[model samples]
Target: MSTKQIEKSTTEIQIPKDVKVNLKGSMLQVQGPLGKVYKNFKKIPVLIQINDNKILLRKTGERKKHQAILNTAKSLIQTLCTGVVDGFTIKMKIVYSHFPVTVKVEAKKVLIKNFQGERAPRISMIKGDTKVVVKGDDVIITGPVLTDVSQTAANIQLKSKVKNKDHRVFLDGIYRYSKSKGIEE
Candidate 1:
C-alpha cells in the first residue's frame, strides 16, 4: 500500500478528575493523586494537545512508522493518566528448588541471598520512586509510574537469573506472577 493511503491517525484519552497535564515543547508532565510522570517525546514528530479533560494525539504523516509512533504516544499518555489515579503494582514470586533463597529490600536495592548457594548476595538496584516489599516468598513492587514498577521487578528477576544451568532442572529464580493497577492490599 502507498504511504499516502496510510492516512493520519488521531487518538483521544480522557483525563481523570484529580489529574493535571502540562506540556512544554516535546516534554509532557502528568500529575495525579498518586504522583507525577514526566515523558519526553522529542524523538517522535507528533502533536499533543490537552483540552479540558481530554488528551489528543495526532500524527499527520501517513507513513507506517508515523502511525506506530502515534499509537505509542497515545498509550504512554493513557498510562500516565492511569498511574496518577490508581498507581501501579507488580507481584513477583521467589522460587528455589535446590537451595532456599532469601530476599531483602535495602535502601535503593534488593538483595538476593543464598541464591544458587552463592556466598555474596546479588544486588538489584531500584530506580525512581519504586518500593520493594518482601513477604514470605512473595515480592510486592509498587510505584506511581508503571515504568519504575516494572523496571524494579525486572531488576529483582534478573538478579536471580541462573547462567550456564539447565532451565528445566534449575528453575530457581524470582518470577513476576502478576501486574495490576492500584496499590497492593
Candidate 2:
C-alpha cells in the first residue's frame, strides 16, 4: 500500500504504580490490590507494546476502522487496569410505599420478592464475579469490572420496574442512589 493511502496513530496508556500488567501475545493480564482482570485483543488490527509502566497502541492503515479499534483497545486496557486497582461500586435502595420489598442474592442471580405486592418474584442476573449485598432496604452491587457491576445493578433496577403505573404515584422499585470507584470500607 502507498504511504498516502495509509493512516497511522499512536496511543499511550500509563500503568498505575500499584498495578502489574502482563501482555502475552494479544492477551493482557492486570493484577492489582483489589483483583485481577484479563483482556484479549487478538482479532483487533493494532500493535501493542509494553515497556516499564506504559502500554503503547499503534495503528496503521484502514482509516477509521483501525483507529476505532486502537481507541477501544486503549480504553479497555485502561479500564481493566483501573478496575483491578480501585474496583467499582453501585448503590441502590428499595422504595415501596404500599408493600415492602425484599432482595436476596443467590449464586449468579438475585431474587426480588414482594416487589409492589407482586406474588411472583422478580429476578435479576448478577454478572461475572460481582458481589450483591442486601442490607435493610439498600442493595449494594460491587465488582472489579465496571461493566459487570453496572450491568448487575441495572438488571436489578429494571426487574422491579412497574408497568402501566404512574411513575410519580408508584415510586416503587430498586433505584440507583450513587455510583463510585473504589469499594466502601
Candidate 3:
C-alpha cells in the first residue's frame, strides 16, 4: 500500500491565565476557574505541546484520516481554552407530539415530566455548578465549562429518544436550536 504525504498547518492559540494544562500519554487534562476537563485522543495521530502562553497540536503520519483527527484535535483544544477562559453553553427545546412536557431543575438534577404521557418523571444528572432551568417549552442548561454543559444536554436528548418508532411520526424529543458564541446547533 502507498500513502500520501501532506503538509500540516500550525495554529497558534492563546491560553488563559487561570487555566492549567497537563499532558500524559494521549490524555490532556485542563483546569481553570470554570472547572476541570480531560480529553483523550488515542486514535488521533497527533502531538500536543504546551508552552508558556499557548498550546500546539501537530498532526503526524501520511493517512488522509489524520486530517479529520487534526481538525478535531484543534477544535477540542480551542473549546477547552474558551471554556476555561469564559465557558460554553448549550440551549435545548423540549417538543411534544401529543402530551405537554414540562421540565424543572431541583438541586443538582433536572426533572422531566409528561414525556410521552408517562406518569413517572425522568431525572437527568447534573453537575453542582451547572444550572438547569425551564421556561414554557424551552429548557435552558448552562455550565461554567463546555463538557459538563454539553454532556447534560446530550443526556436530556438521549433520554427522550423513541425506540422502535418512526422518527417522522414521533418527533417528541429535546432539540438543540442554537449555541452561544454563534456556533451552529
Model 1 pairs in collision: none
What is the full ranking by lDDT, best candidate first?
A: 1, 2, 3
Q: What is the per-residue lDDT of model 3 for residues 1-185, given as tens digits with 9 covering 90 to 100? A: 32333335445567878788888988988888767777887866788888887888777754567767777888888887777667656788888879988887888777788888889888888864667777787877776567778788888888777767898899998888866842222
> Model 2: which ten-residue window has the lowest total lDDT?
1-10
- Model 2: how far residue 113 lies from native, Å: 0.5
Clashing pairs in 2: none
TM-score of candidate 2 versus the correct structure, residues matched by position: 0.87
Q: Is candidate 1 or candidate 2 better by lDDT?
A: 1
lDDT of each: 0.88, 0.87, 0.75
Deviating ranges (above 4 Å) for candidate 2: 1-8
Best of the two (2, 3) by lDDT: 2
